[model samples]
Target: MSSRDDTDDLRRPFRHTGSWYKMGSRQSSVMDSSVQSLREGSVSVLFCVLIVALGPIQFGFTFSIFGSLSNVGAMVGALTSGQLSEFMGRKGSLMIAAIPNILGWLAISFANDSSFLFMGRLLEGFGVGIISYVVPVYIAEIAPQNMRGGLGSVNQLSITIGIMLVYLLGLFVNWETLAVLGALPCIILIPGLFFIPESPRWLAKMGMTEEFETSLQVLRGFDMDIVVEANEIKRSVASTSKRVTVRLADLKRKRYWFPLMVGIGLLMLQQLSGINGVLFYSSIIFQSAGISSSNVATFGLGAIQVIATGIATWLVDRSGRRLLLIISSSSMTVSLILVAVAFYLKGNVPEDSHLYSDLGIISVVGLVTMVIGFSLGLGPIPWVIMSEILPINIKGLAGSVATLANWLCSFLITMTANLLLTWSSGGTFTVYAVVSAFTVAFAAIWVPETKGRTLEEIQSSFR
Candidate 1:
């Protein structure tokens, strides 16, 4: 093939229609089946994502909370979520998580002192921590293999939406009202969980044979034949059932360790890239860059993230995960370098100089580019890859560890960002730019192409 043809092949839309079974004669075109599959699965996946996304909103909104305490709370929640998922199942764990979310919001909404605010944020962090792990796992288990990447991308998309909402709302409302508004998703999710079926794979894993079949029917559509898919789940579950409780020592095996490394590494890279630092401190970054309307610029940053993440949902399954990550990290590296250069020049140029204005514009443009680059790839892909790669037996434990690493890195970046900024504005972003450069190399070398593969197929590749 010509070079152009190679490029076109890489960009070509994924052909898998997600039709798990042979459609009857009554079924229409391939488009119809694909649409039907998406329609049936979208409702459950989107609803679950919507509920879990509240956690990300709370995460973003932590900029308004006390220090790094919220992250500390998330660390605690991350450690606990795995056990809750195993004991209560995905749906029940999410339901239980909602109570803390609601109460946490209430505490923040009516805080009489710093103590209430701190406690509230900690509770909120804990709720989000559980949500971070469960939402993707649940979605991956229920979605059809063909559409899983697309559906899994929704978790990140919802998170961007949540963050954007909080950013916009914070402009007008007081902290208390914003806290009250934050409670709304948990309230909706608590009741909405009842309507959705438990994950079929989870049910099967637990030996609930009849419930597994029923849950699979609900997700796949009642009229559809589920025999093949049902058997696949049973076989996958049976294979792992012998080791229902995955111990830390099991991670010594390559099959378990490889995906775990991928998961933890991707998340660590995602956080170390300074996405959260840029997000939480965009207004300050803009102001320091000499933008008069820092709030508007921050809003624009949030908007870009939401739009780019939205685009990722459509592209993830189509363009494939690894390519996007490469593109994203490369773009981010360039953008961060641009931002660092702009800041470097800002300090050197006199305020009265004509070049100062040019530097400010460069800084703003570079910041916007960085946000777009992140939203397109780093923002969503790590979570998608994380959800895709881990085996069912080790998923709960490994996922928690990966998530904890993500939050811990986030805390370190957020806590030190201002100090670093104060030390040297250009140098701060230079460090992040170097990390972004490394991320490109990491994606090229370690990240696998997970598009058009079943969860089992993806996991088996690690062996």
Candidate 2:
């Protein structure tokens, strides 16, 4: 690594200095943040559309299909592509992942049965697996520290927005219409392929000095002042030892094992909070409670989720990471408790139809509280934390690992919810309430504040 002539770069901001952006399997000029985030934010919206819609589209008709397996599909994609991404660069890997959903759309559009729907969901999961890691790491690598949380969280916000879009659209259009809407995002990928730059981190790691320079320029919006930023990238890249290898056996090492457990535990706890059950089963819960108007429940839930998640996004950077987890988790735990009590009351009501004794009021309040608790914490924080702690090198693999746990936990939660309803309706609600209590303990003991930390700093903490 050469010491950059600071004076020269300061004077000639736009001149070519043969910096490192030039070395890669592909070539490109440096780009700016606005362009980068726009592309990333758009992709994030597409992912949201697919994820929220997949459950309703695939499992709405069938009880046994299980929505979380779609999450598992993402896990599988992450596992397969994790280390592969370190070699390929984030942009290339993400573009590759985007294609599966396109294929998934083809399958979904013509689907006639569970098999086809399942396969479509499976493919969509695979696409998420590939891209989820790439996104946060991309934002982390490119975004200035002051703006990291806001920018990193655009993915989560888009997802909430996407969920809002689908639920609203579902009312006006049929399942097929929503399914088609899921595929429309692929169109963005075509332009993304030509415009988006590779991870500058990856470029620097390989020491492709010339290519790095051009990539840096474009990444910085070709600003002559970008040299200082480019140099920061250079030092960050240079600081890490270049030789890297990953083996399954590496999982046993304390450094890897600890953070991996932390990451996955956060994922598991996120689902255990009962957030997803509320999201997927909102209308069902409402109807069972004799809470009139399924559309009202669904739309209300969507709107609150969007609003609460928006608040979360706004404060995620400022309010601090650990605080949100405590607040959100505590709220969810209480909400679930209210929900269980409501179910208990509903069960004992003279006809399971009793309109009064204040049971109905309690049940409705419980339902809304569940949505609020989830939107604020369980729904968004896990993704943000996962993105924060996992660096580019291990991102795909780590994300896959954590997300797999997330999906499996989700499947268990949903299945258990169904089975509990059969065995004892009140018991199912109580179980999650119990889990929520345990998660609070876990968050307090284990999860750290990640709000203001950079990807490197978070990684360093784990060590």
Candidate 3:
């Protein structure tokens, strides 16, 4: 196991870029705290609905129209947003992202052909990717330090919920209906604009003291020691400036190279885990394994993903980063091997020959295990670790690089999975199996323990 040593909190002191009190004599506690009422507000509920409903419009019907474009767009968005949010600040970037989301739903619902659907999906994917990148940064910045992990996780949680909700809706609703539903979030986002504060850290750095304080109070309420936290924020931000912004020169520096490497590794392992093949095309994989039923296997795979992700949410914090990755990676490796073996066995048996096609049960077992293993380890860890460790100055750049790697890998894997399945039924899955085993070794040796460590501390570990 990698070293799991306790280290001092690595939060650098904050220094607001502009600390002038410019936002209406500092919003009163009542006004400032209003943003915190997201749970009670109709707009907030609508916001959740908007996010969750995107599944249908952006992701309905598996591999066909919505889901494919959505995934690609999101990858592009995540990579782009990583850079955009850093420079534009988290709030403005997120607000801008909402447009395409709304547009996508409209186009998909109204369009007549696959071309319109594809265009809409492309737009939706771009917006979704932005949300995935920006939301975590926003949430992490808003929450009090102790609550950051729990709250930041909601970003990913919303996505999982969104995906699952789309799957459930597909049980009955048509894609057209789902496309209309996806628009709900865009409309709701307009109202949410009135609330959900600009990230305090972002505002503060931009030199908006009053806005920063107001954003903080809105999210934190009166219970937290605002004065103390504000001061701490100042110190942290100040320390960051001393390190200088990331430049090409910084890239050449030996001190920062390890994190860059880790970033690449994180995204590489994420896609290499054989997750996309199972998620986007589990029904197909099931059919290949002699389980010809689409409806049953798709539902089963989705259920497995949900269950495994639920388990991962619980275990990730407790098990810590290193152990969870090792275990999850190892389990995924074994399960992939099983899947490949099963596929090979089926490939050898002539379809015309009467054989027990009931291996659906066995295929389900193998796939479920692999999915569970993925949920527990590489699925969540890559993003979490990357987000947790990357330094603030270059956080967006590094995240973009890593996420770009993920998208490329996903595209390659998905494309290859299809080509290989067509070219050699037994071979592509074998490659995926090898990839999974290699991921186990990567997690075991290269990845480090990041549990409970502050972002700066984790960054230092790579050094």
> TM-score for each prediction?
0.90, 0.80, 0.80
Candidate 1 residues 1-463, lDDT tens each? 2345324433433223235345777456654665676576567556655555544555455553363777778888888887789889999999888888889889989999889988998898888889888888888888877777777877887777777887889889987898898888788787878777888888877877668777876676544556667766666666676554767787898888888888999999999999877887888899888889888778878888889988988898899999999999999999999999999988888998889988988988988999899988898889889988988887778888999998899789878888898899899999999999999999999889999987877866776
Report the candidate with higher TM-score, 1 versus 2. 1
lDDT per model vs. reference: 0.81, 0.64, 0.63
Two-way lDDT contest, 1 vs 2, winner: 1
Worst 10 residues of 3 by lDDT: 1-10
Number of the top candidate by TM-score? 1
lDDT of 3 by residue, 43-81 (tens): 433343334223222333234424556678778787788
Q: Write the per-residue lDDT of candidate 2 for residues 236-354, one digit (tens) a residue.
A: 55544442656778778765776677778888887776666666676777777666788677777778877987788787788876777778877877877787777777766675454
The superposed Cα distance between candidate 1 and the true structure at residue 409, in angstroms, equals: 0.5
Model 3, residue 145: what's the lDDT? 41
Off by over 4 Å in 2: 1-69, 112-114, 216-221, 224-233, 243-254, 351-357, 391-393
